[model samples]
Target: MGQKGKKIFGISWNVFVLGLVSFLNDMSSEMINPVIPKYLTDVLRTGELLGGTLMGAIESLSSLFKVAFGYISDRFRNRKVFIFAGYALSTFAKGALAFTRYWWDFLSLRVLDRVGKGIRTAPRDALIAESSEEGKTGKSFGFHRMMDTLGAVAGPLAGIGLLYLMRGIEIERAYRYLFLATTIPGLLSLFLILFLLKEGGQEVRKKISGVSALKSRNLRLFLLVIAVGALGRYSYAFTLWKAGELGYSLEGEMAFYALFNLMYALSAYPIGVYSDRVGKKRLITVGFLISALASLAFAYARGPGTLVLAFLLYGVSIAIEDTAPRAYMADLAKDFEKGTVIGAYHTVFGIFVFPASVIAGWLWQSYSLTYSFLYAAVMNLLAFVMMFWIRDKN
Candidate 1:
């Protein structure tokens, strides 16, 4: 039975608070994501030199940190401390971006922000899963993702507005103001998370064999396939880059990015709720199918108008993709091992993302956009086929 009036939208109060945290955090993040590549290229003078490769490298390193943070959180049986540190650290990263002068400066701030993300994500997800009522896991994760993407939508639109206001202003100057605006939301996120997040009764740490979390066959298969798929899904920095290559200005590209997030926000919860009713593995497979198709569309897009279609399809793929795989991984976890398993899954999956971006960048530089995206399409198709091996048992 539902919680009657005790809970909100079938999720616990902690879930709601965590979702609100993500909403504000993503608002701060998306404000900068759309403009990062452009800012590097035009303002920082690093575009032709280290653009995609460095973006990939920083993100990869951030993913690597998740392993350590996850292990520590499990070891201490404390999620709130790491989560508070993560949000606070990200808040610092956002404000620090106001003075970035070179590529390394940007890298340092971005990595710091991502470090916070890596630290908090696994433990936070474990908290949500553990707190959810039976049969509500998918919907809970979906609701959190919906709030997150809603912030993504708002952030980019806010950036677009700032871009217009700062038009005729120096590119770096405009971005500085954008950075300042994001800090407000960032600080709010930190404050809310600090006061609102709960650790509850801490569980005792269990001793498992070395890398014991990977002993489950279904979990192994799931992680491997997802990793393979992620190799094709390189830096989304390329998405904004492609839009600019097609002649859209920064504001225009941000608008499309907003559209992408809008579709994702609108669809994520519904898809998650549906996955709960149907099956997570089945919905995840369908996500792979949609992702393969969207990759192809991105490959062929020639104008902002075409990109509209691509982003919409990409949003559908993302909405379906976001909720299911992680929820399935959660389903496969032992009670005390959820954070570690989730971290391991993320570590393996993220290991390939750096190389994927490097390869995509090389193709974009040496080959063509079509080649770059088609490579991704093939990988997603492979992932789609691989999903069948997973049983999705709870």
Candidate 2:
């Protein structure tokens, strides 16, 4: 930890800076994210199944690179380079969305953006884990998530505001301009990563196999449970689509999306701090239960009021989902293998994102959107049941 960065709310400087980096990047990402599903459906006219496939492919396909990049970082003992490169790639790729006129163009650019995510996420998380003081791990991660999700909250609101400003323009063109505008924040974040964020003092570089972490029985079983839980962790696009299905305008859906992020940002730090005291697995188990309930609520939501409740619950559930698992993995990992373990967790979670979103889409197209939510609900419950078998490390 750098001496200069140690003063922000008592966390080390690296954690704080990384949090800001995530904040800016997320702001850039979410500006487009809330609109992408609707854009695909309305503007590109891809329909439910194809739109879902494209979204899923964007998420899952790039995720395949996470473990590889993570291990490479571990081998090099250099997190900053990878982190910097990842953000740069995503920034440029996201900016290219302005030129996309077809779904394939959108998919290509989105996949490139996610590939950047894959490169950065694990190493960045591992860096956060390394930056924290021992018992404050949860606090550090929670604070980071709070900052990151604050960006998520801001991004949609910003997008809505930008759209309002550009209302006179054709909708598709307005969306294009918004995508191009996201590059500003992305570049700012990249600048922070390159200049301000500092790595821990270098160690004597050593060659090690990152995948060795997978040999632990506990890690393997925990990963299995995580995979199950991920099956229910469908994309937020589904929720956005639901809002549209229920007759909300684009701005209304953006408001709802902002609301979801608000709850997530508000709860993340507290839940993380609490998990440090009580137990991570307990809260993680609770998160699964909440996810199940939220999914069921989404299935039966009648109007805006019910949708509000569902989104709030879903937000808290996601706060936990986003924070605890990584903290827990950090707790479980050896100092040398933190990047590997965390990367494995991300890889496993992401590996399922495709099937989960696709399944939701399939259910939506073949039966009803109601069944899609029901499937998520059931999968969450199964994950909750499986949680009982895994022991918490810290």
Q: Quantify how close model 2 is to the true structure by its C-alpha RMSD in Å.
A: 1.8
In candidate 2, how many clashes are counted? 1
lDDT (Cα atoms) of all candidates against the true structure = 0.81, 0.88
Candidate 2, residues 128-199: lDDT per residue as tens digits? Answer: 887887777788889999999999999999999999999999999999999999999999998898899887
Highest TM-score scorer = 2
- Which 10 consecutive positions of candidate 1 have the poorest summed lDDT? 200-209
User: Candidate 1 on 161-251: residue-level lDDT in tens?
Assistant: 8788789998778889888788889888878877766673433244533546568787778888989888887677887787888988888
Off by over 4 Å in 1: 1-6, 201-213, 391-394
Ten residues in sequence with the least summed lDDT for candidate 2:
201-210
Candidate 2 clash pair list: 5-13
